[model samples]
Target chain A: MSDPLLKVDNLHVEFKTGSIITRAVNGVTFELNEQENIGIVGESGSGKSVTATSILQLIPSPPAKVANGAIYFKGKNLLKLSSKEMRKIRGNEISMIFQDPSTSLNPVFTVGNQLIETIRAHKKVSKKQAKQKAISLLDLVGIPAPDKRIDMYPHEFSGGMRQRVMIAIALACDPEVLIADEPTTALDVTVQAQILNLMKELQERLGMSIIMITHDLGVVWETCDKLLVMYAGRVVESASVKDLYQQPLHPYTWGLLDSQISEGQNSAEPLASIPGSPPDLSYEIKGCPFVERCPYAQDICYQETPQLNETIQGHAVACHFQTSEHQLERKEREYSDGDAT
Target chain B: MMETLLEVNGLKKHFPVSNPIPFKKSTQSVKAVDGVNFDVYQGETLGIVGESGCGKSTMARLVNQLIKPTDGSVIFKKQNLIDMPAEKLRQMRQKIQMVFQDPYASLDPRLKVGELIAEPLVIHQIGDRTSQKQRVEELLEIVGLNKRYADRYPHEFSGGQRQRINIARALTLNPELVICDEPVSALDVSVQAQVINLLNKLQQDFKLTYIFISHDLNVVRYMCDRIAVMYLGRIVEIGTFEEIYANPQHPYTKALFSAIPKESPFEEKERIILKGTVPSPLNPPSGCHFHERCPVAIDICKTKEPKMITKEKIHQTSCHLAD
Candidate 1:
């Protein structure tokens, strides 16, 4: 196939607190096809957000250090780009929408000002033109009364409105890639659906690749074409959305799927939560990061880190078992039988 | 069937919004909770699901008497909680507690973990100092925290650990009913499961009733025995989990269920996307609050308010079409 729109190879991110260094992203690698939407799903501190930020070179300095990694965007290595080049790429070629709009947005600036500034930063346009573009962007995001809302400050808008404003700003430059980090985690269910659908529609219209970082598998299934499961700063599983849900290879993926199952089905059976807390990143480990929490962990899993292995078509799982085909067939049989009953 | 632990009738909380301009009409009341009615049965979880600004949190606070209702009666075991004296209210508080959303802010930073848990027991004068200490330790153990960490301050604990401590403090009084307002929304997905499991175990062990309020339908579906869907200061649907999920009658209910992300690898279900944002509680729609955005809205839905009509046994919904 042609070169992916973005390619991440052997990426590692470390944070220094006092004298100790914590590896937040370790040897992570993934490829995003042009105009494809991929979701990186994991709980907080799982390095999902960090991985996205690393691609854009948004990691804060002093404490945060990208020790090793190669991030290629449209055949250009993002890591090797100078500060000036990176600035041009950010919000011009790539943009990100953070989790909480209440805090992510500047309180003092009007929504229009933020949108205009983002546009002017990338394009040499007149102030009036920028303002017009701002209004159109707001209108595109489905914000009603865009002309009136343009002058309203962030605090004036409600939580959901503020999120829409953030989206408008993110799309100001019509970037080729959009990194949405937990975009709807703070919104209610109905509002969440609205935002997700809006993103999907915008992706189709703009034909831009999107990296959706969220812990919710439900969100991933709804919007994402591919799924990457992260754990303790590592990509434990990566596969097509259909394959991951149909025949999950990693135990962590199984656990996540099981947890969500009890939500959809009103079963009296207790939810199957992962056994232990996520491993501490401050200390280095010899084996798999999820070994402590995995129910199917073996001595080999604890003794040596497993490489990402292709166990089924378009499915890669970093686990020793490699029984995805067997499990997939079994589940299909059970599902058909259950439906027949 | 479990006994009813708490019953709320016509509960309302109206906050007066003052005009910014001086000498202007001073205050206009916002009906945050407008005549909401529900019950908490012993050992059962009642989930209150709503959008933001739908007054779910306000209802939770009113049930705990954190904020007194403007008009209504809260009958806890047949005693009118609204009419109860302050001392009597204080006494009643021992049997009812609350767990707030933000673990970081809800906890006292200066106080040790042990003192945080002990404060409730001390306030109610449940036992002697030594026994209270022992109880605090026991509570920690029950919530899956090591008793040895009780001396540590709130800042030292992880988000999940702090929430576990919050749950422990809420359970210190052995309350019959606990109101959890978005308790797990702030935690990670994996940690959310851990805290939810702890809550389920505690409910079973102590026969505690829970008024679980959340905007997340997934979490509510897993936790609640019965679910209530709320819109601008009103409950649009209330029924058993099975009844609502399997056979949702209200248009809003169907829209909500469709909004939830499907887990299976099947084709996507056509979502009934609501038209507009939730109406302002300050000035909600005249008739049915959801009529402004309801896809199946009729003329009567905009002109005449619908009453809570019973469809199936114990299933109640406020929709003109349901009639």
Candidate 2:
């Protein structure tokens, strides 16, 4: 097979203030193939966003740095590239949409102006040509009456419309990769569905690899072909969406799946929640980062750190346990016990 | 039959939109909680689900009398809270407590956890300082927090811990009805589940009735016994959890449910993508508020509003095409 579209190997990101250094992304490795959608699912402070930002070389120096990593895009190392070279690749190749659409957009400028600026920034085009392209992009993103609406400022649009505008800007330069960080988190469920569907349609039509960074597992199930479950700056589980959901290996993944209040869950049963919060990232850890919150944690769990190992074809897990049956048995017992309570 | 703890009757709150020219009486207003009515039973949770600006938060505020309504009556324990004097309402506030979203913003940074929790007790004059302090410690323990955390300030705690502090503060007065307005929306998924389980447990222990408001349908289903689906400041459907989930009659409710992300990638969900965003409340539709976007809307829907039609003993819906 040809090389993957983007490969992140042994990525580590850190932020330092004074003498304190917070390890945000620790040894995150994944591969995104052409036209394949990959989801990095994790809770807050899980470093999913940091990993995505570092791929585009957006992390600032001094306070924040990519301590180690090799991000290979088309067989070129993004980390080794200078700022000037990276700027050329930033919007022209890899574009990102942020969590909050309102703040990401410039309130003072019209949507057309911003899109045209991005188009002109990457390509050698006339202002009129860029404006026409911006209008077409807006139409492609499902914005109604792009010709008139494009002149309106960001505030004139609703949350969902503004998000579409953000997507239009990200796709302005026809980037090969689109990194969306919690794109639909701020919108309502209906609007979220709209945005997710739009992304799926755009990916298939444009044939570009998408890196979706979101906390919602349902979203991953809907849009992504593969997923990486991160906890405490490390991927606890990685597999195709079907394999991971059917038989998750890691304890953290079990906790996350159990905690979701699905249709089967009745009001009488207490939600099976992970007992404790994530560990602080500023300090150093000896063993597994999830040991503090793992329900089946044993002495070995706290004493030894588990590396990501492929247990099945294309399914990797970072845990001491090799079999998923053990995790399933434990999860069922916990659920039944919760029901009894 | 379950006893009604609180009743909301024809509640309406309209904020006047200021005219561009000064000193001109504004003719337009945003009908935030227009003609909303629901009842809270003695010990049950009633979930209100709606999108932002659909007035779920505004309705919560109106129920507690935090913001006065333009026209309506809030009957709490057979007494009208709207007409009650300030002193009497202050006395009545002990029975009705609220847990707000954004745990970080709801709490005061300068105050200790113990002092913050005890502030409700002190204001209500429920107990002496010594008893209040003891009650604060007990409440902290009840919410699954370390008793020693009482001395620390709000900034010291994580999001989940701070929310626990908020719950403790709300329970300090031993409220009969706790209105949680998107309590877990601000936290992470795992922490959100923890808070939800805590809320459920507290309800059983205290026999508390909760007016839970959230946009997350799954959380609403897991927490509430009865559900009310709201749209454009009005309830489109109200029914038992089983009824609402099993057979959603309202077009809006069905659309909302269909919009939820599928359980798995293998399950093919037919999503009903609404054509446009919710209409502006300032200039709401003339007839049925949802007619503009309703897929099954008819000719009469644009000229005439639909009243709440009782489908079953406990199930009601407001839609022209539901029948």
Candidate 3:
């Protein structure tokens, strides 16, 4: 489909400290289309953030390195790009917002100053012109009375407002791709709703593609079109939001959906949480990383690591036993049958 | 009839957050837990669900006597704990304990896991060194920890394992009422399930009463028998989990429930998005704390405070729209 807007193929990122090495992002691959939103879902240390950071060359090289794979954007592989070329593309083509807005924005600097500097860095605009653009960007993100709020320091704004400021800064360059890493995680649900709605509005107005990284299924369900579920370090499943939720094939995805404590999910038995803790990233995996936690794990699952296989035309799952017989309603499956123990 | 374990009536805690500048004589108070009321029934779990700064943590602290209330009283076992003698309060603390969020921060890194778990028993002088060590080992096993690992430090364990250690420590005193403040929020969904199942089993075995505080409605719904929805330092609604989730009367409660991203992307339901942020508790809307952000707020809501009203049996709400 017109060489998808951004293609991340077989990407691998690793972190080494002393004698130890961690496979942070293990051969993750995906594509992002123009105006499309992709959600990457995983718990802490699942390598979701590592994959995002590797795309921008943001991971520090001493300890962090991309061992294998390529990230192609606009027909050029990001891994092959010079630091200068990557810098130009970072804000002008791709921008990011982190989880904590309070730290993302410098507390000592005025919010307006940060936004103005970001605009000038990516565009050939003067101080006066960039300042004007900064005010409008703030206005665009729905910050009330942008004229007055523009001059306020980062500490002056509340958590939600600081997040809005972060968004305004990210949109300053009008990047074609916006990568938000847990943007609304720090805010409360009501405020998180506000930020999510603001993002939807901004995406429509800017027509920018977004890669949303989050653990909340509901946030992904509401914002993203395609969803990727990550475990230990690799993607276990990828599909359209509807397909992923409706007919999830991976045992890990199945357990994750049932693990959620959602409204109207009132079953008598304990939550169908995947048993066992997350797999360690430092250790090299001989078989499936999730074999320790998978309820349906069998001899095949423990013997070999499954490759990402397309079970349906648009849906892909990485599981040895993602057959029709194994696809039972999450509620009906006895995930708590103690196989994981 | 259910027996009441803890009764809180008109509990208030105001922190004077005045501008810290010379020549400014402002003494404004942040009503962190203002005029809150609830009853935790015997052997039942009561969930307190609210966003940050909504006083969920403050209310938990108040019940545990970590902070004294500015007004009203906390009656546990029909004894007002407000000004209980230090010796008496220390004794009462054995019947009530707390498990905090962020296991990494809650646990002391310097101490061995066994020493950390046995600290409570040691302080209360419940058992001598030998018995305390044995009890610590037993508690570790009950929470699904390897007994040998107790000799290791806190940093050696995973987040889920540390949390289990926290539970082991909290239960050392055999507290009848446990306040689990966001106990599972920091853990992964898989680990969260392990902890949830552990807590459920522990409650049944110990016959413990729980005051579960969390921001996740789904977790609260699953854990609590009755739920209290808080906003701007006040409970806007309280009811059975079924009553609250299925049919919420309060506008704030309704909007809060709708705001959750649906379980499935295909599940279509009209989402009710609330306007504006929660008003500061320092000057809480002058009347209904939620009126500023309430979807169906009336003119009277701007000036007249709404009292907690029982719309259905055992279901209480504080909204003008409830009538």
Candidate 4:
């Protein structure tokens, strides 16, 4: 196979406040292929957003810093690039859409103005030509009556409409990679479906790879090809969506899957939830980050940290007892029990 | 047959908009909760599922009398709460409690966890200071929190733990009916599960009824016995969870259910994507509020309003073309 489009190798990010330092993204490594969609799933403060922001070198400095790692896109390490060189590639090669569209958009500017500005920033085009392309981009995102709607401010559009505007702006420069961080989270379910469908359709038409960061498994199930389950600061599991859902390896993945209130769940039974919250990122840890929450954590879990290993083809897991028969027996018992106290 | 704990009859809440012109009275009003009706059976959960601005929260507020309704009556335990005196209503509030969304915003920053939970007991004069403190400690243990942590502030706890404290505060009054408005939407899946399981267990131990409001269909399906699907400040469908899931009569309900992403990626769902956004409540569509976005809307749906039609023993829907 040809080389991957984007390679993120052993990335570590941290934030410092005074003398205390908080490790946000610790040794997260993954690759994105051409036209492939990847979903990074995790709870709040699990470092998924930090990983995505670090790709564009967007983490605010002074407090936020990239301690180590390399982000290679098209045989270029983004971290080593100068501010001038990076600015050219930031939005031209890789663009991002944030969770809340209402805030991401400039309240004072018209939708057309923002889209045209993004287009003009990356490409040498006349104002008239940029306006024409902006109108077409708005139309491509399924905004009704793009000619008239283009003149309206951000507050005039609905939540879903504003999200479409955000996507249009992100795609204005025709970036090869689009990073969407919870793009559909703020909208209604029906609206979320519309946005997801729009995103899928756009990916097919534009042939661009996407990095989708969200906490919803259902969203990933419908949209993503590969999945990365993050806990605390590290990736606990990574595999194709189908394989990971069918035969998950890590205990964190199992807990996440079981915690969901599925359609087939009995109302009388209690949901199996992870018992404890995520660990504090400011303190140094000697072992697994999820040791406190994992029901099957043993002495080794507290003493040593496990590395992400590909036990099967294209499926990686980070757990000390991932491939043991004893773990299999315990997993079976846990599944049979169904309820966690 | 289970007894009805609360009956809402033709409830309506409208906020009149001020006239843009000077010295002019405005005729326009936002009908936030227009003509909603439902019953909460004793020891049962009734879910209200709808999109934002669909009046789910407004209806919850109207039921608990946090906001007064423009019309209709709320009958709780054979007494009309709408017509009750303020003093009588204050006493009546002991039987009904509410847990709001946004755990961080719902709690006061200055108060300790124990004081926050015991505030209801202190207001109602239910127990002495010693007994209230003991009750707070007991509630902390019941909600699976360490008793010593009650002396700490709300900022010290995580989102799930703060939610547990909120649940404990709501239960302090021993309210027969608890109104949870989008309780788990803000939480992660793992923490959401913890809160949901806690609510379920508390209901069983206290023999409580719940009015669960949320936009998530899966959570609503798992938590509620019967559900009412709201649209544009009105209920489009109401039925048992099984009946609604198996055979949804309203086009809006069908579209809403189909819009939910499938549980597994391998399962393909025939999505019924609705055309436009929900209409503004200031002036809902002349007839059916959902006709503008309904896929199977007919001529009658635009000009003539549809009434609730009973399809099965308890399943009911309002749609011109349901038959």
* TM-score of chain A considered alone, across all candidate predictions: 0.93, 0.95, 0.95, 0.96
Task: Looking at model 4 chain A, report the run of 10 residues with the lowest lDDT sum.
Answer: A332-341
Better of 1 and 4 by lDDT: 4
Q: Assess candidate 3 and give its lDDT.
A: 0.87
Kindly state the fnat score of candidate 3: 0.64
* Per-residue lDDT over A73-135 for candidate 3, one digit per residue giving the tens place of the 0 to 100 score: 988998998999999999778999899998888878889889988888888889999989988
Q: Point to the candidate with the largest DockQ.
A: 4
Worst 10 residues of 1 chain A by lDDT: A332-341
Candidate 1 residue A73 C-alpha distance from true site, Å: 1.1
Query: Lowest summed lDDT over 10 consecutive residues: which window, candidate 3 chain B?
Result: B269-278
Which wins on DockQ, candidate 1 or candidate 2? 2
Q: After superposition, how far is residue B184 of candidate 2 from its true place, in Å?
A: 0.7
lDDT tens digits, residues B121-238, model 2?
A: 7777777988988999899888988888889999988888888899999998889999999999998877888788888889889999999999999898888899999999999899
Which residue runs of candidate 1 sit more than 4 Å off their true CA positions? A323-341, B23-25
Any runs in candidate 4 off by more than 4 Å, and if so which?
Answer: A323-327, A330-341
Chain A of model 4, TM-score against the native? 0.96
Q: TM-score of every model?
A: 0.94, 0.97, 0.96, 0.98
Candidate 2 vs candidate 4: which has greater lDDT? 4
Clashing pairs in 3: none
Off by over 4 Å in 2: A323-341
* Model 3 Cα shift for residue A305 (angstroms): 2.3
